[model samples]
Target: MKKSVFLACLVCFVSVLQAQNFPILGKVVDSTSGQALSKASVFCQNTTFGTITNNEGLFYMNLPNGGYDLVISYTGYEKKLLRISNTQPQKDTLLFVLAPQDNSMAEVAVVASNEVADGWNKYGKFFSDNFIGTTPNAAHCTILNPEALRFFYTKKRNRLRVTAKEDITIINNALGYSIRYQLDSFSYDYNTKISQFTGYPLFEEMDTTEDVKKTWVSNRAKTYLGSRLHFMRSMYDSIITDEGFTVEKMNDDPKSTKGSNIENLYDSSFYFVDSSGVSVGWDGRYRIGYRKVLPDKKFLQEFRLPANASVQVTLLDIADGFVIEQNGYFYEQYDVINSGYWAWKKLAELLPYNYEYE
Candidate 1:
């Protein structure tokens, strides 16, 4: 028994000695400004253990000795990743230079319905060439209601797993006229069930001149509200869709009672090509417009836009199409904006390229 106990103790001591551990400490900062990246999320790919950088962009964690793929994410910046294979308790400084998301297809081959042309290899090349673009100005923005920008940024990988239903409302207030709106409804699987619904005043009780002046929040909210509104209104006015995703000029839903008298005032469509002959994707090129309602129903919330305001995805040369649907709702400004608009939300699904619809 004495020999057995000694053997067990010896084994335990050896095991402890063989175990490996290290302390990983680092500071994350903006490459350009050298400013600390606060609340940045740091994690290992395919693992649940994670930590967030402090306000000073500093993080310290004890990790097992092994190779790790580390991901760093923050609001208004492109995600950064690094492969670390060190086991020394050491301090390291990492600088992250974030680029904006580009929203253009640099090259695309268009084939008619009858021709089964050779599969093209333009998708990857186009995405690569077009990956370079300037980020949107951090100084400008349009307001979003129920703003969850920070929450989305601080989460894991910026890959959001929304619940059964989700709502996104964008409002445009240009030239002091509250016009242009887009509402999206989502299913549990996270497909956009509806893409765009325009012309409906997202709310009633327009902010009075007094309210606009008195009910002021942060400058971020003000800029977002103003910039988003301006961008949408400009797109609606300049759209010339002779060739692109067939944009509907008017709401066909008989159930829609929004701005019924405003002839051709509300339109929704997919914009295909810019003047430069570049094929744009629905993710960014498509412009959604909304209309103004009474003062009582505004749904504008405040949040920060990504400094790099663009996101571009390149697809395989498959004929992937998106489904678009729209619906109308009665004006209930407070509940709609505060709790999220139900009827006005939209969703979309990717259909096979060969699929056709009447």
Candidate 2:
């Protein structure tokens, strides 16, 4: 089967499965404005079976008779994840209210900022500068990240290795597929911190010759890493900074003089667009990009920021406050972007208000 044809079949198969049996129905609205979010993606994690919100921000999906993760995600707002294990014969009606990201603690219950106006501006500036054009830490390995993320999605696999850094190659025996995300080279602009990434189409050579093979891979890639890439770009374009960034430093330092070699994924020597600043101390400001893997709900991994940068972190939970049942069902897991999930590790060392700036 051809790659393109395979992917299409894969999409249809997942869609059919999601639509089987009974379906859940609901609308998504902005918590702040009470407005509907149209074209929003409402789907089950690990499966392509899902629907997009209409003009009214309404969506529906059919699920098997088991526990499943219902994820609602849209741009410019936080993502929502809900677990539904429904035995009800009637359609389950669900509603979601997405809150605007709190730019400063003064704007929310966490009163860290003394001047709401100034702090909000600082927040806005941070986003506007860093997120205006491209995204941060995004130019490298668009292909391999998908498989690593898929391990989390399918929950069927455990270990994942990117056999080739130049290409994202994965061996998934359970899925009956071997996937490859080949890339052109990686380049970056140190000033902007925007990594320009280019890639070849996703390919899957499977034991079975099915038409949906490619589409399945494509859909999965887009659903996971592709969406992340898009979000990363959005964040970079929206980030604002006082220092602003430019591609000033360029190096292929195989050593990756920085703390981690992950940064080496991109051509260190090439100049790319940038926006965020290097946080010099507990006083510096930044708009950080962060995402937590679910199930474990622990801070498993993170994209690093300048070390010792005074930072503020926000936890976007499955409802506003759906307490994670693990960890003694703590109200929520509080992880910092710069600090990974260890924000509470040394909370006493940072300021109380949750604001980095004085």
Q: Which candidate gets the maximum lDDT versus the true structure?
A: 2
TM-score for every candidate vs. truth? Answer: 0.26, 0.30
RMSD of 2: 22.2
Q: For residues 1-358, write the lDDT of model 1, one tens digit per residue.
A: 9999999999999677556545567788877777887888676532333678999888876655444556676655656766554432355665554444332431121121121122113222221111111112111213343332111111223222111111233232321222112222111112432222211122212355765534322322332221222222233334322111112222334344232222232223443323222122232121223222111121221113233323211111112222111100011112222111212111111111111122
80: Cα error in model 1, Å: 1.0
For each candidate, the alpha-carbon lDDT, in order, equals 0.33, 0.38
Candidate 2 lDDT, 72-182, residue by residue in tens: 767656668776544334545689998875546524623431322333233333222222211221111122243221110111232111111233453443223343433
Error of 2 at 296 (Å): 25
- Residue 16 CA displacement from its true place in model 2, Å: 15
Off by over 4 Å in 1: 1-19, 87-358
lDDT of 2 at 135: 23
